[model samples]
Target chain A: MHRIERYYDSIFTKQSPEQLARDIMKKADSSAKKRSFRPLAVVAAAAVVLVGGVTAAAATGLLNINELFGGRISTQDEQFAGELVGAAQDFQWTTSDDDYVINLKGVTGSERDMLLLYEIARADGRPVTEYMTNIPEDGELDCAENLGFDLNAGAFKAGNYRYHYSINDDGNIDVYNLAVTDGDISGQQFYAEVINLYPKQLLSDFEAKHDIFDWAGGADTPAGFYRWGDNEAFDAGQPCDVALNDERIIGLELEWTIEFTYSPSDTAKLSKVITDEKSVVSLNYEKSYGGVWTYPLLRITDSYFSSVSGRIDLVREGYMRGQTFDTCNDIYLLLENGDKISCTAFTGVSSYDRHEKMSSFSVEIQYSEELNGPITAVDISKVEAISINGEVFSLI
Target chain B: MQGDEFTQYVRKYSDMVYRVAYSCTHSAPDSEDIMQDVLLKLYICEKKFHDDEHVKAWLIRVAVNRSRDVLRSVNKKRTEELQEGLSVSDEEPSSDLHTAMAGLSRDHRLVIYLFYYEGYSVKEISKILRITESNVKTRLKRAREKLRAFLNDE
Candidate 1:
């Protein structure tokens, strides 16, 4: 095989056809039923709405911030808000550039997660009428108005945005929920800038030409990672750990370093190694899944294995394309005396990298009877199948 | 397609759709979700396919579009790495290639997977991805150069 072809083969594992058939059929049946039911449901809903005086509310002059938020806060924000004892709620900070004046209304939530409430206004003191006009009559902001947080650290993340027009007839006031999961942001003060302010016309035009929410190769914005200096407004503040309901913003210029403390430890070490022309098999044992149990790990380099075994252990299950299968049930340990002992409590840990055509697995097994003699090779002919290039080979 | 033909269609093209989705999303759950959505779309689509190639092309297009939708959603921030659940492979190239692919941008990886692994010509890929043929060729070339640089650096 060519070098690149082999690498590609190793990475893309063909899925099991039978399992996929079953899943597809199930979904198809459900969708067919839903398709049939939709028309009747629409008729029923129309009759009810006509009798109940349920008219859609019309848009008002100034957008209500509380109404826009809908009182929905993420779990992280709730937890952060619960942790702070005395979070400030009355500080205000403002900064302005040539194009816009940015105001920091308040900071709330905990060290783990924070909510920054701020307003952006045109420097010419014009009501952000242009931006508000583009908002749908239902007060829904299109995908273009969704300003994602970009970090300079190159880590990808996601956040929630909620906003409405300022009550005082100013510009837009929005709440940005900034969350840090794999790092610490406790008691840290940093500068935040509003980077890209899209004009109403361009946003409306872009939203019209494409599916605004459809991400497929069209929306190229990095979801959670922040790019430094992308937003150029120089506004610095110390976010307090308080309830998300707190609206007090604190103004400060503080330098803080974001430190990451999340790390992954290697849980397994090579116990036995096998070298062959086409493959390398390594036996390993590691503590995983909360360190309560130790799993036998195997690294099989080369062709995928339907089943693999060492002198002492046997793998009874296999995994491919993120699906697990009990490929083998009954396993026996062949001793030097030509007798066999049944194995029980078999657990397999199968890992495969399709790009390199390598599979690693560790099986934890318990024998029914204690052995008194030396053992030979493990019998794996009972495995259901092994697949390579969409071809399945039965071990039996 | 209906019933038996639809079953055959899924059996024939599900893997291709899945690979394309995985190449873009890199998350197993996300890929599976995309695969399911694409297959469901195919099952319900009234469009008739002239041949296996046409069906395959349509599936790839849907998979790519659905995968992009998942990536662009507000919840696309993935806290866990793809390899976190499984043990690291022993083969150097296997792990190295995974890291290298991860280093490349999603756009670069998608073109490379389509051109090399899926065996699609530049023209076919351009149609499947809704881009110009020159764009596809350029992405493929740039992807190869980036892959070479990554491998050499490693």
Candidate 2:
């Protein structure tokens, strides 16, 4: 055995992991039981949950955004009421439709998080799903969930989360959040444009549950949501909503351009900070071969923050060795109320090139799994500080 | 994923998971406890895998996560647990490198084990740990430095 392998073996061979594995599996079989359900029924149950609650939602064909946003917070059910409601910032903007209207109720945030309020429903929504038969077939599910909308600002593309919706007569609300990461977002005019939607989540779940992925042909659709039997040429095995921009679906053609100027709240405050740190920026080693590690200086000419978003403007001092990569530093908004929010989700192109000195580009601080979803970061009194790359700039 | 197929995967992947857990916790008992939970999770995990590689990947990831949890929960008793659980065999390497590695943190040991012992690149390790590649590289370098520091102290 290789000496290193021997060393590792000596450390662990005292316990026979392979034997243990067999033993555990035997034990697992003795203790566990198997359960199965029809795939179509499971899909129905999931749809009911996606639309809203099961028991109450089946009675009404429309969605329950209020309940879905946090939970049914009736005073009678005081449990959910205490934790969530106060933190969301309320707004009233509804796109009108005959069957359903998409409305924005509010966005909840933390310093660097734009967490969507709830879990991503797929083939998982339960009891209420069986009752609510209005479950959208294909593209409807995409529209029902948050489809990515492009947010355009002056030169930089702003960051956005999924815009989720449910259509109903009781003013059902659909919502999405933009991370306040674009530091210079104050007074920047932006118009959110709804575009093609992809049912990647649903497709994956279906594949996992029923193994019905490739059966639904999606070659014709540009935006990836399947249309019902768009690919008769390929195989009519399953239905897909691939024709997302098909004019027939009115929900898909939300052509109204609602232009809005984003001005920070009156209580909004700003902080200024700068950094010129010289550090080993990147390492490029792939064990089969020797690799290069670069020592680059991150020169920030100016980095600023409003209460909502945080931005750090960079001025590069040229790499000493290898990389000229993009550095999307995380922008955090620390609220007065002990909550920390990471609002910087930049959709713009942010890369630092040695040839192009001090270029202002944007890259997403790619929300790690840690910052998974839309967070409750709203309704805080004031932001005490904004942290960027380990440096805290006070905003209070 | 059921029947003989499930058994085959559990037997193969569980051993990999236990090795990963052992590297992270350096405590056989803790590693065993973590292995049990992760094994049951494997037995019950519904996510279908494309291949044995996928199953191995999932198991190792779960093992790493579970080991971290054990490290955190047993932080206070860690020193006692490590000494008690790991009996130094007479054949154990007395090299300065080994000594330094022995004193290193669970995170450092984990990164080192994945890189040197398992032949996984920093990039692959980053994906498994859900951290940036730079972070994985940084951990490796820091582990080396801290290990050398231990050798110097000796």
Q: What DockQ would candidate 2 receive versus the native complex?
A: 0.13
Report the Cα lDDT for residue B20, model 1: 79
**Model 2, range B1-154, lDDT digits (tens) per residue?**
4646766765565556666887776666777788788877777666667887666767777787666556545362437444533543456654555556667766677888888877888778865654456456556656766776776798
Per DockQ, the best of the predicted structures is 2
Measured against the true structure, the TM-scores of the candidates, in listed sequence, are 0.37, 0.40
- Model 1: lDDT equals 0.41
For model 2, how does the per-residue alpha-carbon lDDT over A1-396 read when each residue is reduced to its tens digit?
154466666554344555665666777666553314366777776756644422210010122234233332332211221133234434222222122233334445542333333221222222111112232211122222233332221111232223333322222223343333333322221222322233222222222222223321211111223232222323344443322112112112221111111112231111101111111101111110111101122344554544334455543332112121222244565668866675534443334455433234333333222342664334435767656555566655
Listed per model, the TM-scores of chain A against the true chain A are 0.22, 0.21
- Return the interface RMSD of model 1: 15.7
What is the lDDT of every predicted structure here? Answer: 0.41, 0.41
